[model samples]
Target: MAAIHMRMLGYLVTLAMHGGNMLVMNSLLQGPVMEDPNIRTFSAMYKRFFTVWTMFLQLFVASLGLTTDYYTLKYRNKKEPQWLGVMRSVKNRIFAAVLWPTVFLVSSLFWSLYHYDRSLIYPLFADKILSSTANHILHTAVIPLVVWEVIFQPRSVPKKHGVNVTMLTVYMFAYLFLMYYTYIEQGIWMYPIFGLAYNKHICFPLIISAIGVMLFIYYHMQWFLTRIVWGSQVKIKK
Candidate 1:
């Protein structure tokens, strides 16, 4: 009973934090940031970035988690409804397979490149427009929040790990396609690192392949951590 209550509290807290971050991001998009000609030009493409997409995914997973918890509490004495069970399954799969890995990848890559050369990832001028609070929430805070979810919320190990890998592969390629499409249309690479490639034909594939490998490693690392924390026999509520 205490564990159940704690999980509920975790869900509520995550939902509130992500919800607040979303509000901050939205305000930045709609507020005075748009007054800058450079920012205004890229506003439409903002949602196309992986960071924005993962943030939405985090917000969604938190929202679904809270809803599932609410219904579970309300129906504690009754048999779980089919809809609730389905919702729980979807939330778990998405959180485990997609959101967790993406958050880690985005945070790791952003901080690494930002430190190496802000020009490659985030330029100095961006600081003039985007708030420090918003930057940390988007890039830094997500790491801890997702880690908290994994540590506290027990999720069933997928019977077939290939399914998760396949989903991740599709997501990676889809984003790769979007990035290339943006370059074709805008005549600029979304990230300056791509522009630095002497031969994009060779370098881009290598970079993407490296990212794919990292994401695969991240997936297995997450699975191993889940098992370590929850044990191999962690059961899911039907």
Candidate 2:
């Protein structure tokens, strides 16, 4: 009972956190930042951002967590249904395969570039649009929240972990394609770093390779953390 209660509470917290983030983002769209012609133009391409993509993923996983919990609690005294089992499996897979890795990657890359030289990734002008609170919610808070989910949530390591990694690879490459497409269309790089790259031929591939390596490391780190928290064989409650 206590375990179930804790899981449900965690789901609720995750939902509220991401829901609040969505609200913050929505306000930014309607806020004074849109008044700036540059910001207004950039906002049109906001969906192309990895941060926005990850935020949507987080929101989705949180919703799945809550729905799974609701059914789990409702059927506590009875045998679990097949649909509930499927829901649990889907939620677990998404959390491990997509949500965890992306959040880790975005947070690490954003902060690394932000600190190294904010102008490279996020410029001074961006601060006007992304307030400190929104910025932290988008980049900083996500890391701990994902870590918390890993520690608290029981997830089985997928039998075919390669599939998960492949999915991530596809996503990264798709985004890379989008970056080039945007540049070709708009005559500008999606990120300022691309503009400063002396050799696009060399730098772009290196960038993608570095991201691939990071995702690989994060996947293994998640696998290790799951083993530590839930033992070698994680027993998912159906």
Candidate 3:
């Protein structure tokens, strides 16, 4: 079971990284393919490129989470499973399923709020490519998914593992740098907080706020993982 969860998570992280990288490259090359009335530019090249790449990425990620869920149920009471007691109920499973995307949304919102005046993160995601209403709904729904994954997903359950706040901090730095590259290359903004750099002195504060959000989310997620994965256990009496 540990092996299975590990493989699934490895695949999920791989898809996210690969998809993000490809999307960044696409953005850099394409520079925001806005559907303008004057320009009929929904070419075969564009469709095919996104189609195959996105399909594989989405498939692997979805499969990882679903497969993890399946394994959890199959070996719920089996000893020697690394993910034992992680999902004690249907609610726990559901939350685990939704966690990643929910984290993305909440983290984005927190960053946006802290850097409210900056507007660097605001401009990129402002335009609704899929229509404003649908986009808004999509954004709102993603938060729950992210939260669930954090709260319930089974991990290796390492007790007494050294909590390195430094590593978490470094990850946020790398994520932001890559995010900027993603925005520049893909010509689309993943977070609105990247939209505000209107030649103002707001960059430093916004970046700081974004980092804070990342830290908060990271520690919170770590705590959640510790609580459900390592801290809690159900013992069977003979």
Question: Relative to the true structure, how large is the alpha-carbon lDDT of every model?
Answer: 0.80, 0.80, 0.45
lDDT of 1 by residue, 1-238 (tens): 5555666677677677767876766676767667887687567677887888898888788888888888988999999899999998888888877888888899999999999989998966577546888788789988877777777776656678887887888888898889889888988777888777625678877888888887988887887788888775464344
Better of 2 and 3 by TM-score: 2
List the candidates' TM-scores in order.
0.89, 0.89, 0.44
Mark the regions of model 3 whose C-alpha exceeds 4 Å error after superposition.
1-62, 71-128, 136-138, 150-171, 180-198, 221-238
Give me candidate 3's TM-score against the actual structure. 0.44
Summing lDDT over every window of 10 consecutive residues in candidate 1, give the lowest-scoring window: 229-238
lDDT of 2 by residue, 37-70 (tens): 7787677888888888898888788788879888
Judge candidate 3 at residue 58 and give its lDDT.
42
Per model, state how many residue pairs clash. Answer: 0, 0, 30
Question: Which ranges in model 2 have alpha carbons more than 4 Å from their true place?
Answer: 232-238
Better of 1 and 3 by TM-score: 1
Root-mean-square deviation (CA) per prediction: 2.7, 2.6, 9.6
Q: Cα deviation of 86 in candidate 1 (Å)? A: 0.7
Candidate 1 stretches with Cα past 4 Å from truth are 29-35, 232-238
For lDDT, candidate 1 versus 3, the one ahead is 1
